[model samples]
Target: MTLLTALLNGAVALSTAKIPAKRQSLIILILLIIASANSFLHLWFSEASEHSTNIFVTIIASGIVLSNRAHWTASILFNWVGWITISVWLELALIQHFFFAMAMSTLLSWFAHLARKKLVTKQIELEIERDLAIQHELEAKAATETKSAFLANMSHEIRTPMNGVIGMIELVSQTELNTDQKNYLATAKRSADSLLIIINDILDFSKIEVGELTIEFVEFDLEQFFEELIHDQHFHARKKGLTLALSKGDFHHRHVVGDPYRITQIMNNLLSNAIKFTESGGITVHYDLVTLGDNLQLKVEIKDTGIGVSETALPFLFDSFSQADTSTTRKFGGTGLGLSITKQLCELMNGDISVKSQLNQGSTFSFSVRLKPPRQTHKMASKPPVPVSFEGLQVLLVEDNEINQEVMLAILKGLDVNVFIANDGLEALATLSHSQRLKFDLILMDCQMPNLDGYEATRRIRAGEAGEIFSHIPIAALTANVMDSERVKCIEAGMNEYLTKPVKIEALKSVLVKYHKQAPAQH
Candidate 1:
């Protein structure tokens, strides 16, 4: 009766105990519940033997204690009492029962210790992996920032020399020269322009990598865009003795809303690549429409019969600083960032790019992008006509450089316009102040001059004593600063039009005509 009562009390204690550790807590709880139910049944039934009840309780209690390191000693004491009681009840040998209980406890305790060590080791390994990932991420961010700083510094350094070269070339072209000198100057100018383009590509790639690039969508004529692109690239193709051809697809309309600058950039990169690679065969560009569900996409394809890319080099074509071959770098010089920038710009506009090539035959690059159809609103068939001549017009030319001043004078000589020259902004102000009797029609202000720059000069003229006479004068800003912010600065500085240095004759003529008609009537 005492043995049976002890078994019932042990079963209730085991059932009430809960496993605290999470790894095997649920399994431990389930085993304990099963053992408790078995013990209650054995105690309640009349046919169940006391020896069986004692043996079952001893085995379950031993397992629970052996599975946990904290309970091993207590479990052994409890199991020993149960085992002895059962052995006596069943009339079994005391030595054999004691040996069995000791062996079971030793084996279970060793197994539980081994499992606990392994669990601790796994947790340490996970912590190490997480720390390594964080370290790598930080290193990558530092490298990217370093690269951006290098690119910005390089761009500023390179552009300064390029501006000097192009400016000097413009000044030289205005001088009286033999055919040989003129031809040499033209070649040098072309090389400088190409270098400028490469520099721009590098700057653009840096902007893209740092997430500073953005697209602006504006209404533009698709046909006009194509025409301008062809005009700009045809000279390069001609110089290389390669044929350049364009095949326009049937678009049913001409005007579309898109980012003209980015589209032009992509087209220029593709066209320049094609021209650079091809030596004998021609290059061709074609476009077509793609229909996907309800959306319309445009696909532009540029194909060239050039020394094509190898199988190994094809994969890294769009990677920054990677070129097709080392010899290609020496033979066909580039910064190798054009295609990388082109691909990123396309993706920024929700488009994709692809390329296909053979070893020696040729290569074809393609891109696709969705665009809304042209609006059906009324289209102006004709633009307002510009005046054909700048004859009999009064012009002001302000420049600090003597060579540049002479160059401007020579260009304006045959235009039949009355020209006045000033060495600096202060000189320009004096000239204007003294010449109030003969009202100046147009003021061409140089942006960077001694005593006062173009911005301050324009402001002063607009706010000075000759406010009535010069305030209404159409002042055009001329400078080498071609950045978008520079353009905005010129506009905010009271200038009517902005023209970059090394100005094209046609562009200057157009500006003159634009402001001439818009200028206020004389008092």
Candidate 2:
């Protein structure tokens, strides 16, 4: 009986899972019949009754169920029924006990199959989830890269023309005009300036996102700084029919070192917002030195009567590209980046900012920053000389845009410099290589252009590809990209100075003064 059971089950294994459906069914049925017959026959035989049939049935049932998913139900049910059949057909002692033992074993094995199936299914789900997460991560990185490229391109395209507009407006302002004409010109200039500020806000936010903003500290008179800042904004407040003034501050110093530009930026952001929102009342500003524990901090406060923030909007006031409400954006036009930039600048300078406001009353903003104690300077700060000249200097201007070239030429002419023009980096190289009779005191190179770029041209010049005499000539990158990476890139590519586009006449003169002192005589 044992040999018959083993041989019959072995035949089912030999019929591999690939056997025809009907044939597979036939084979499993035959194993079931023979296994049951073996159980009955063994029960009659006193020697083997205890051990034979159920073991063979378990092997046959589990193997078929695991290997053939299509027939597993039949395999499980028929095998269990086969054991029950044995219990029923036999007239033996303790028949009920035999039936109960077989039923419990079959129930335990079926539960084991279900647990294994669930474990396999869960593993597959986890692997699929991991793959999808990797895909999403890759997509996010690609999107960030795309946005960066778009911003860089947009900045260049916009600033190239902006340089021409603002530069020409300044040049035109220098000429004679009637009172009304001057007023119209002032309005035009203000409009252009406002547009420039918007562009800068967008660019600044981009810089912040990429973690490339730079900060620097300069020495200035504490007394004079507040006076001048108020004076500069007086015209705007006057135009709006709002009084702008500085309240008193508790300070005992004359000269201190701090980031004056950033300080001015923070002040401008707060003051501008105040002026924009206020209809009647004036803006009051205070500068003070406060002692906070062991740290001596420079505290500034601006109070204004304006449309204040609601409780819902107060917490998110400093969030980037966010305003008090959607209506705030619609009523007052702005990119909503100024206050966010101000908050970050405060933090960058080791400070914090806060606001107190009511829905209809007004707002007061306070900022405190850590700064070094004042030190005495040898001389009081003096005003820079008006319309400084670089009369004897010679400059080679490399640029692609015609309007930008004209703008630069006009500015350089005012400085009394003898200028030469090259439309691109290659032309500049060729000019330097061939002009033995003429040498340049400085090369003002633009970063982005067709054919070749400023970085490669500067690299080649440093590598001695543009003749040895011209190789060491000063190259200043005049670009619109103000990102910190661009500055580092210029330095690494062998540039002596870096300047941004819409190049301020003051900045240009500073560049000329420093370079012309080291400039070859009349080159």
Candidate 3:
């Protein structure tokens, strides 16, 4: 009987589970037949163990039934039918053994039900966490986009007024003035320029944070570029009674491909810091070249005899908006973003920047950038002569703001040109349509004007509704929107050139000269 129960347990476990569901019934039927034959053999021998047989039969039935807990009907039916039928056939009708089998199967089923509940709870918790993570990520992205838009709008609003302030100061300074008045104008100009720099730093830091800043590689004259940069730095250094010098390294590659604008910006930051900190002594800039395989590396070291940094503060030197000490900002007067920007630029170029300094002695800032040598050396052209006169030139100035109109009129008046005013785009278009015979050389169109914006006006002009002559006339977009997308919109609207607000006299002159040279001769 013991052997028969063991065989029955093994057969049921294997036949019910290891077999596919479609064949499980047939396999279980065959195994049952075998169990019955074993029981008959045990009966024929009359030498089987009853206790062991009961234990084995109980374990097998409970295990098979508990394995399918979701179908408790099958579990209960199989437990009662299989064990009771076998017990009756054996002629062992003990009520305790039958009760024991039923009790064990119920216990296992209850335990399985609890296990299923726990698994379901765990899965639900994991799914909830996943959804929350996705929601948070979406919120963060939306907030970043909103911040970018706000910064862009604020930039336009602030820069427009600044343009007028600085431009007006420049115009006033051109006239005769006493030493005191000239000093006041100079101080105002300095303040306006400083504010502009702060705005630029904030914008740049935002760009870097959003990963919008990009690097462009183009061939440029390295030596000439450095010479001009150093000349400007030297002028600033001389004003403070400090000497600024540049020493060239041994390996000389005159022309190389890289982003000249970013390189100039980085150098300007380093040199500005060197000059700002040094009160008594001078600043030295050392440039060297290191050859790595076929590529050449440019290493720049800006050594300043200034109030150096403390050891504890050096670690945070390249961190954004961080300074060496609390008193540093008050004494030096900066947003403390220069070094952070410089370091980021270096890394963008696949290079690195480091500093070595002593609190009272001096500091040396070193950086290295990988560069590609151009196919041939190139020389920079001498600057074009400044355009002094544009007599008989007719320019239509379309602007809504009275102060901006006055500013543009003053600048145009200084150039000895005939200027016509239009308060809005509608007026400018009407002026063009009515005065078809009058040949206008250029149209300075202001974006975001009342009645009609510059973009719409330019589009109409391009469509040739005003006149054939109007369509060919160069329309330059003048506005406070200096964002890349704004420039793209201007171009798409058929504008020839883009000028940002609080337009400088020199930049205005350059634009006029460029178009005047290209402008058709008066009919």
Candidate 4:
């Protein structure tokens, strides 16, 4: 009933307010007076039915119509009173079922409006949350890619110089030198080696972040592994005048299954850190064995007498780029990624790590890993080691740089090989074609050179431009392009082997021996 009245009154107001000359204040006053007149007429003329008294009483009780901004509160109160009054009166005047129907319709309309508003608000909130999550994911992905690229570029830059330094050092060590000169060379070599290790740590951390690093299981001699570690670090410890010791536990097995490279890396990191901070006391590594049915676990502990970490810093010890303190980083120069890599490696091997420390006293780092005992196999008789002599071997050295040429000549001269020099691939081809009696046993062709490079020259040589005498002779690539794709290109170009610069004497010797022995069968 109330709804019917409101619709009727709305229609009346719309029709009257459409007049062009209607004044706003006069419209409002006229609406109020009409509403009041209708209320009083209903009260006076209605019969004493169930709805008569209630509907009339409520309509006459309020004095306003067309509720506006300033009258909204009073309008709401009047609407409720009028609605209840009309509902009661209609029920008495009619079948009494209309009251319940009206009430339900009004309640349903209010609930539907509220539900629509809530759903729209929820949708807006969900949109904001999804946008925020997507933004965070994009930021994380960009940061990860950036870190990977930086580590790759950094590794290449650092390793290039290190290759030169270490190669030169190896060559120098074989030369005749006094005791003092040899000591200086050794020190420089050690420093270069340490720098290489730091570079590797950065690479490892980056690999871990990008999910590219992996561990392999293989059989290796545990004693030999430890021996190499101790030998390598003994010099560093001695330089600091600190005692380095290792204690071994007796096990039935000498060989175990695990990645020797990753294991050595972990031990190296722990030992290096221990020696780096130790000033006056010793460092010790102890091992023990734990058995669980068929599986064996090894517990390794590295204890050092060094400036230990504070209790507060222990929680973040395994976090990347976190050192015990800023002073530790200053005194012992490092990027603080070693322990982080070590911890990651341990977990990859299905192991756990722990640490204990006291300030100014010492620290002990321990890790445990499970290992399978290596299966026994029949040992083949080892080949008798052959004494190497580069005599009677004909070598063609193609290089563009004068310093590099001299360096190569010096190394070859020491090997007692018959060496032929070519400044470029063009010269090398000319030499091979012009000489009637001098046929090269092996060509060490530089990849980048004037006139022609190693690839084209090797192609021409294989095409028999050097005559059948020099054709098919092993052409080993002597280039600085060490990437796997570069090596594949050399092989595809008919070169027998690829060697990266700055080349080491041992590697060069191995290549010589391999080709020299294989050359006879090819001819």
Considering every candidate listed, which one attains the maximal lDDT? 2
Per-residue C-alpha lDDT of model 3 across residues 1-523, encoded as one tens digit per residue: 5665665666557633545533554454455445545544553356343543443354444334223333334434544565455556666553354476556645664665456446545755887899998999899888877876776678778887887898899889989999999999999998998898788777777777766577778888778888999997787899999988888987767888888878888899989898888898899988877778877788999999998989999999999999988788888889989889988988888889999999978899999887888766666566698778888788999999888888889889898878999999889989999998998999999998878999999999999878877898988899886555677789999999889876867778888988777656655
lDDT of model 4, residue 64: 26
- The global C-alpha lDDT for each of the candidates, from Candidate 1 onward, is 0.71, 0.78, 0.77, 0.71
Model 2 worst lDDT run, 10 consecutive residues: 63-72
Residue 130 accuracy (lDDT) in model 2: 91
Query: What would the TM-score be for candidate 1 when compared with the true structure?
Result: 0.61
Q: When superposed on Cα atoms, how far off is each prediction in RMSD?
A: 12.0, 8.4, 9.3, 13.2
> Taking the tens digit of each residue's C-alpha lDDT, what string does model 1 give over 11-122?
4454335533443433443444444444434534533344344444444454433335444344444445554554466555643644655555446645654564466457
lDDT tens readout by residue for model 2, 1-523:
5665485556556444566645665665566556655654665555344654454455345543343344445555665565455545564333454555556655655665565446545755886899999989888778767776677778888888889998998888888999998998899889988998899888878877766677776677777888998999998799899999787665665666678888888898999998999988899998887655544578888988988889989999999889987788899989989999999989988999999999779999999777665455465658656446788788999999999999999989888898999999899899999986687899999999888899999999888888888888889999987777788989999999999877888888888888777666645
**Model 3 vs truth, CA RMSD:** 9.3
RMSD in Å for model 1: 12.0
State candidate 3's TM-score: 0.73
- Ten-residue region with minimum lDDT total, candidate 3: 62-71
Clash tally, candidates in order: 0, 0, 1, 1
- Name every residue pair that clashes in candidate 2: none
User: What is candidate 3's local distance difference test score?
Assistant: 0.77
Q: Residue-wise lDDT of candidate 4 within 1-523, one digit each (tens)?
A: 4643664465336533544323532454344334534553453456333433333332332222222223323433444455446435544343253445435433543454345346545755887899999999999889877765565455545655565577678778988999999999989987887776776777678788777577778887777778788988898899899999988897756667778878888898899889988898899998876665666677899999998889999999999999988888887789989889999989988898899998898999999877777666444245445337777778999887676677778788777778889999889889999975776788998877779988999999899897767878788888754333456679999999787666767778888887667645553
The residue ranges of model 2 lying beyond 4 angstroms of the native Cα positions read 1-138, 217-221, 252-258, 291-296, 325-331, 372-387, 520-523
Per-model TM-score on C-alpha atoms: 0.61, 0.72, 0.73, 0.59
Query: How many angstroms is residue 113 displaced in model 2 relative to the true structure, after the best TM-score fit?
Result: 14
